[model samples]
Target: MSGAKLVQGNEACVRGALAAGCNFYAGYPITPSSEIAEIMVRRLPDAGGVFIQMEDEIASLATVIGASLAGSKAMTATSGPGFSLMQEHIGFATMAEVPCVIVDVMRGGPSTGLPTSPSQGDIMQARWGTHGDHPAIVLAPSSVGEVFDLTVKAFNLAERFRTPVILIYDEIIGHTRESVVLPDRVDIVDRSRPNGNPSTYQPKAPAANGVPPMVAFGDGYRFHVTGLTHNEHGFPTTDPGDTEALITRIHDKVYDHQDEISAVEEFMLDDAEVAIFAYGIVGRSAREAVLRARRAGMKVGLIRPLTLWPFPYAQVADVAAGIDTLLVAEMNLGQLIGEVERAVAGTTEVIGHLRADGEPITPADLIAALPDPAGART
Candidate 1:
């Protein structure tokens, strides 16, 4: 349990959540993501936390929202299908500004496509699964240690912004084991509480940070929470200005802090003419490919995103500014590659190596897809 113990990525997530002060977990079991819930059930009670296996993913997220409103840090885990079922509540959590975490261990999808195989097919879904326009904070970890690190960060971001945060990784990463040295503790952020008198409290009033200070249900502040467009007083509103303000504020809360929220690993990008843009499990393969390319006297690098939403356009743009060609590799046919293309904006040639056959894109696959280094400089 100490000093570089071997840990599965899914197991590390539970450990990280506990360290981040997660005291409640409610989830239905599903492949790839089931380990997180299974571990939480056994470990939570011992940590003085509560764990509940809801009837399904929808109820699972609903229970987590209820627990979060009660002021406990809450979380849930699911795979592609379960995640699909949670979309409605995901939107509700966004509209209500509920602070919580949802972990999605992705598998080949489009309706139960591959239950036990690895796939990054949920990349776009994680960003836009919920209906309507809403801010999304999604973290994708490529390794066991990063799974732990980002899980803790996910909770912190959720509390800080008072919005749902998602931790997404492919099945391979979830099932893979690696030696990771988890820290004894990590910095924790709790949702800001009401400062003024409870008599005049307005739950949805935006602070300077664009996020309203949250008052838990048991904290004596009576406020409303609804999916309908609401006023600062948290009551239903149809006024044009109120609706616009409500929607815009929720977005600004995250976008205004995107620099803090966005994270990427740029490996050997300097002086490199070619770069690979990848995330999740493919990030590891891309990293190895970069090393192999370098050994072949090719100037190849990698841009592995840790925080996927807000899309890291600025980071990708900077990399594209210098590189001659940016190759995107993912387990899906094409999802994030379009985003990468937008980020590059013709600054560099963009190409993709995509697959959705429930198998990973290996280092050799990426290396083969990469442009000829000898001609890349021309």
Candidate 2:
């Protein structure tokens, strides 16, 4: 937590995984996200862990799930198209309740999109990328330093809830050079270990918080885990009651304790009639807007959500209560802004400074959207 060095966003992600006790990474090299694999190759081995380059995105995701089942803190990283390729496996991890981290460094795309460029186009995909009605715990890190912090939190959330956690970042955040202060590994949280005899342990036994103690496959507990909804004994269940209970618990455990999961940063929002809301690199531009708006005597503010999923609805809603015009700005064409609308209802007019080109959202882009915003900053 001392000296800071300039590092790429992908490498910072690797450090985050390492600090979070992630020991297994199985991924195919994809632009933007490829640096995650690259850094893991050089770092995991030195930490007495394993790294693998699977043949394809599907295999990469599948192998990571397998590693998680085998009792390792596992993860895989990919960009937009690769994220598309891993959908079924992501579904597999979700249904199976496997704890692993999937870092999607977003690039422009419908197919391959923009490989080396930044885009927030995958916002919806991350929400419902996998097939079915499972819940997602997605984290978006706006800065290189934040990418490291949130990666550790992503693993903790995944392991705690027994689900696949997605760390969504844009190409801008993944490749940007910034100074990040590394944390001591001891300060990070590791997954809870089951505290019982291997032969007698039960992976499906419900705990007070709905999270069953996790034991790696070879290390101890012998239990069945499948994508199929299962009984408390871990065997697939045909009972409608059984399926309902499993799915509900998966969603509740996270939703119930949202205060622990939701993270955001506020900038000069107090007493402002208008505010700009955003995250990732877009937030930086919004920050600049706040500064300029304040200098020009305009009552404007900014709200940046560090965690995208488990959506910061409550926080955004609370802040919206005091504002008149709430502007939502992002690199995507009004994706997150809709969430702002949902939170604010029709009480606040939410303006959008939307973008879809393979370029970073700039301060000029946002300030240009508002006519005389700086003049009203007083």
Model number with the top lDDT: 1
Tell me how candidate 2 scores on lDDT.
0.85
Q: For each predicted model, how many residue pairs clash, with residues at least 3 apart or on different chains? A: 0, 9
For model 2, what is the error of residue 197's alpha carbon versus the real structure, in angstroms, after optimal superposition? Answer: 4.9
- Model 1 whole-model lDDT (C-alpha atoms): 0.93
Query: In model 1, what lDDT does residue 133 have?
Result: 94
lDDT of each: 0.93, 0.85
lDDT of 1 at 270: 92
Candidate 2, residue 86: the lDDT equals 89
lDDT of 2 by residue, 1-378 (tens): 359789888888898889989999999999988888888999999999999889999999899999998888999999988999989988888777789999999998878878999998888888887878877788888888888888989988888888888999899899999876777663465557778788777677668888777778787468887888888778898899988998888778778878888888988988887889988888888899888877777778999988788889888988999988888888887788888999988887888888888988787777667646345523
What is the per-residue lDDT of model 1 for residues 94-206, given as tens digits with 9 covering 90 to 100?
99999999999998888988999999988889889999999999999999999999999999999999999999999999999998888998999989988899999999998
